[model samples]
Each structure stands twice: as structure tokens, then as C-alpha cells.
Target: MGAHRRKGDGAGTVPVGGGRDRYFDALRALALVRVVTYHAFGWAWAGLVFPSMGIMFALAGTLMARSLERPAVTVLRDRIRRLLPPFWFWGAFVVLAMLVHGWMPGWQIVYWVVPLGDPPGNAWGEQAWEVLWYLRTYLWFVLLSPPLLWLFRRAPVAVLGLSLAPVLVLTFVWQPPDDRFGTGLWDLSTYLCCWLVGFAHREGVLRRLPPVAVALLSVAALGYGGWYALAHQAEYGGYDLDDDPLAQAFWSAGFVTPLMYAKARFGFDLAGLARFRRLDRLVTVFNARAVTVYLWHEIALVLAVPLIDRCWEVPAFEAHLPLESQWFMFGVAWVLIGAFVLLCGWVEDVAARKPPRLVPGARPATPAARMAP
Candidate 1:
């Protein structure tokens, strides 16, 4: 979530009007960390632990709604401008790698630039680039936000209440085709309600809701989502919510609702973080390089494997480090991720029209006011 001001705002929705909204900033940082951890380890339970995609979309939706206060065209342009450069910079490497591996070119290749649909990839690039699905879905959301926000504002409660209908309809009435278009449709529907909840949060609709009602609704959604995921694990091959969009949608709704509402209703407190300068700075860096982190994490993990294998050959590393452990790989992945952040993260600064830095949130030689972009 970008930022909005409200009295009594503390944990989840710190007002960005005065400064950075540390709460949402931390959520995004944690979500990005979870995404990398899940992919690195393939933990089925991780989805239940944290529905990162839903949370990310909700955060983005909140930002989008806040941005829509300006001209829609301008907002859209700024968003695309912010998104595409980083993507193109990342895609250039992946696309070039795919071409070197003999990936044939076709019109679908255009998606590498615009990503209106899923970008084509060779087998070697699949794992590294499959995460592009989120980018594609986010692009779609950005494209659709103008109309969605319009309808959402007219009857915020009613529209937000019924926002899950598209996913429900897609789940039961008709299944999407097993193609790129279907993939996009399923992803869009799966996260639509979360996105709308973001809108509600931005406009204070969530803040105004009765606490008991919000809690009950969240419980119902979580209960059903959990039950559905568990019951259908066999059919889906595992209980990962990502494998089942309906469950993910419901689970994310349940999980994210109270969180968005709690900022105003209960003031989930995070102000103590100010006492830990280094920890606070890490959170700031995470938010600043979110795109860079997301784009490079898979490759980082992939690189971690061989590096770990080489380490196994070194007796010192082999005896001292748990080189065989996935946890160890997770650690190595972050190290590589940090390196990538240093090398390529400047694209984000350029996109944001800020002075480029090797790492975000590093103390400047001279003290200067830190402001949220």
C-alpha cells in the first residue's frame, strides 16, 4: 500500500502523508521474502502460512487507488513507466538467454516487451521466467484499475462484497481454457477480490467496518479456504493454495482482510522498530528494491545449487557448513540476491526518477531527509 493518513493509524496503515508507511513497507518486504523462500524450498504449507501473491496485489491495489486520485491516464502512464523499464531490463537478459538456447521467435515474443500475455520461454528459462506470471497479472490489473476503481467507488461496500463473484463463477460455471489466456484469466480472477479489498482500504471503507462483522467474515473465508484446500489436496496433487485458485482467493481474502482493517480498528503496532535502526533500514531497502528482488530471486536460487555443490568439494566448507541443506541454499540464495540487488537494482531508482545508488537506504555521506517515493 502506498500511503494514506488517518488519525490513530499505527501498525498496518501508517500515514505516508508525513513520512514512509513502515507497516505496509514491512508487509511487502516479508511477502517478497516468503515468495523467495517458497520457491527455493517448494513448501506446500508456505501458501497457507502466507499468501504472498494476494498480499502483494492488495498492496499494489491500495497504491493504485491512491494514485488514481490523479488523472487516470497520468497514473497509468506513470505506472507503466515505472514497471516496464525494470521488466525490459530483466527480460533482455532472459530473452537473450532463451534465444541462445534456440527458442524460436514468434508474435508471442511481443509479450516480452508488453506482457499483455505470458511471455514465451525455452525449457531452460522456464523456472526463471515463469514467475513472470505475476508481472503479467499485475500488468493486467494496472490496465483494468481505472474501470474497476470507478465501479468500486460508486458502491464501495456492495461492489467490494461481491468482488469474489468472478472467481466463484470461473470456479463453478465454466473453467478457463488450458492456454495462456486461461492462465491470465485464472490469475486475474483469483486475485480480483484482494485487489478490491485494497481499494476499500485506500478509501477507508475497511476502516469503517464493524469489528465483529469483519472478524466473522474473515473467519468464514479462512475456514472455507482451509477446508477446501485440505479436502482437494489429492485432486490437486498437494495442498498448496497456489495449485487451487479458489482456495487461494478465499484464503487470501480471509488472511488479508483483518490485516488491512486492523490498522484502523486495532492499530497493529510497529513503532518499536524505530529503536532498531539496521532492521528498519532493511525493511526500507526491501520496499525500494521489491521488483529487483522478485525478478532475480529465482535465478539466485538456481545459482545457489551449483555453488553449494562446489562448496561440498571444499572440506572446510563441507565440514563446517550444512551444504546439503535447503536451508543453507536459502542462505546462499539471499547472498546472491543481495549481489544482484547491488548490480541491477539501480534500474528501480532510474524508474522512480531518483538518483541511482548501489543499495537503497544506505546512509548518505551527508545527512539528508529520507522521503518515500
Candidate 2:
């Protein structure tokens, strides 16, 4: 999840420089690219390099804080409206596939509609729906934001430190039970600090902090998180942040703080992308249909394997193509991703109550001048 860009007045015009923060949009686009790439290749160091999930949650938290300026009920309604249509549309195919593969139905099927818990799925659909953990965690954050924001306003620094306590307790004292509810709590605790940092950014708390204090705090967090992951790699099987929630929480908190602080304190912006119109437009589209991209990317990668296998049957492709390469599969995945954007992405537009469009941010053509009779 990232900053939710509200639709401007124009129905189909490409998002330009005005009225939107291209910086956040660009961050989201890059984070998404990193997510897809990491999944495709399974690089161990990918999380350390970018910590995309932490960045995403922080961005979402910032946006949530901004939106909460309105009535809480209205904000919550609009947020859920924007999120669920794309999820429901995506879930229909996933759930159907699971049933066809003989997944027995339990009352837990209700979770699929609202996703309050882990939506039940069979082994076959595991790869596709595993990403739902983020949505579940995000939903929890959204539901809890009013109190969180109110609490933060009362004691900014203390609440921010206290937010990390759950993860520390989970790590040192008791582990979450191996159950759906426990899993949800673990996920929520892991990123809660990053989420609060977003609140700090929006409230100008980060901006007011001394740069040296920010740097020192960030470095210490990163150092401890990295050391913990490396030292405990044996227990978790690898230092992959996903495997170790404690490490992930600390690492992401460290990684995201400086970036958010910089942006909050300085006027760090990606407005320069306006000069490269095509690239800016691509970022705009990615941000516009971010949910669609995230929900469908796993399936796209899964399809890429079979599609590439078909290429091996063709003599010309077999001879000339690096068909066996993961890079090739990465290319195929994006091709499928682009196709999905065209096919299913329009649902996002409809969910936003905008005109359903083939391309979310394509520049509207100028109206032809009337010919004089």
C-alpha cells in the first residue's frame, strides 16, 4: 500500500505536475518494481537494499493522516471503497481456482468477502493469495487510525517509541501463536512503527527534529536490526526480512525514517520527472492502478513460466532467445502485467467512480474545433 492519489477534476487526462506530489507517486512506482523484481528472482539482499514494504506502509500512513483531516467515517468509507473492488474482482478468480482444486469449504469462507482474517485458500492458490497479509495488516491500520492519530497527538515521541514495544515483546517474551489471529497481530506489530513515522511526517515532527539526532537514531536502528538478522539467520534459515518479523520491524523502521525525514525537512521532490513526460506518465499510471498491479503481479509471474516454456517449442525462439533465463521470465511477467492492467485495471477507475478507462492517465485528446458552416 502507498499514498492514495485522489483523482483530479479531469476524467482521463494524464496526471501532470499540478495538485499532486509526484515524489510519493514515484516512490510507490519504484517500490512496486522492486517488489515484482524480488519475487521474480528471489534475491536475498533485496529487502536490505530497498525495504519496499516498510516504505510503502509509511507512505500509506502519511496519506492516511492527511485524509483523516475529514470526518473519520467518510474517510474510512472512501478508503475501503477504493481498496475492495479490485480485491473482490481479483479474489473471484483465486477462490474459484482453489475450489476447483478441491479445497473444502469451511465457515472461514466469509473471510474472503471482508478479509478480516487470512482468507482461506488451498495449496494451489497459495502463491497468489499469500500477498493478502499486507492487505489484512493495512485494513487493521485503517480501522485503528482514529485512536492512533489522537494518541500520537497527545505524546508524539513517547507513543512512537511505545509503538515498537509490541514487536520487542513478541520477539523476546512470547511468540505469536501459529494461528490466523496471531498472524494478523504479528504483521500489525512488525510495521506499526513505520506507520507512525508517517504520522510524524505529516505533522511536521520529523521536520522539526535535528538532522544529527535523526541520523544517529536511524543508524543505530539499522545497525541493530542488521546484526540481529545476521546473528539469528540460523534460527530463521535466512536473513530474509520476511522470515524474521522482529528484524523486519527494526530494519524497516530504520530504513524508512531517514527517507521520510529528508522529505519532510527538505523539499525533496521528484517533480523533475515532468521533463521526461513518458516516464512521468508511467509513474502516474502505476500509482493510479497500484492495487491492480500488486494484486495481479504474482499470477503474472506464475503465468510467465508456462509462456516461456511454450517459446522453447518454437525453433526460432529456442535458437535465438535466452529462453531459459530468469531475466527472460521477468520480461514475460511484465508483458502479462501490462495485459492485466488493460483488462482488470479499469475496475480501479470504476471503484474510484471515475470514467472507466483503458489507460488510467492517458492525456485526453484536444477537442476538434467546430468547422464553420
User: Whole-model Cα lDDT per candidate?
Assistant: 0.83, 0.83
Off by over 4 Å in 1: 1-16, 367-373
Each candidate: RMSD = 5.9, 4.7
RMSD in Å for candidate 1, one decimal? 5.9
Encode model 2's per-residue lDDT on 225-274: one tens digit a residue.
89988999898778888777888888889999999998889967877989
Instruction: Give the number of the best model, judged by lDDT.
Output: 2
Locate the minimum summed-lDDT window of 10 residues in model 2: 2-11
Top TM-score model: 2
**Pairs of residues clashing in candidate 1:** none
Q: Count residue pairs with overlapping backbones in model 2.
A: 0
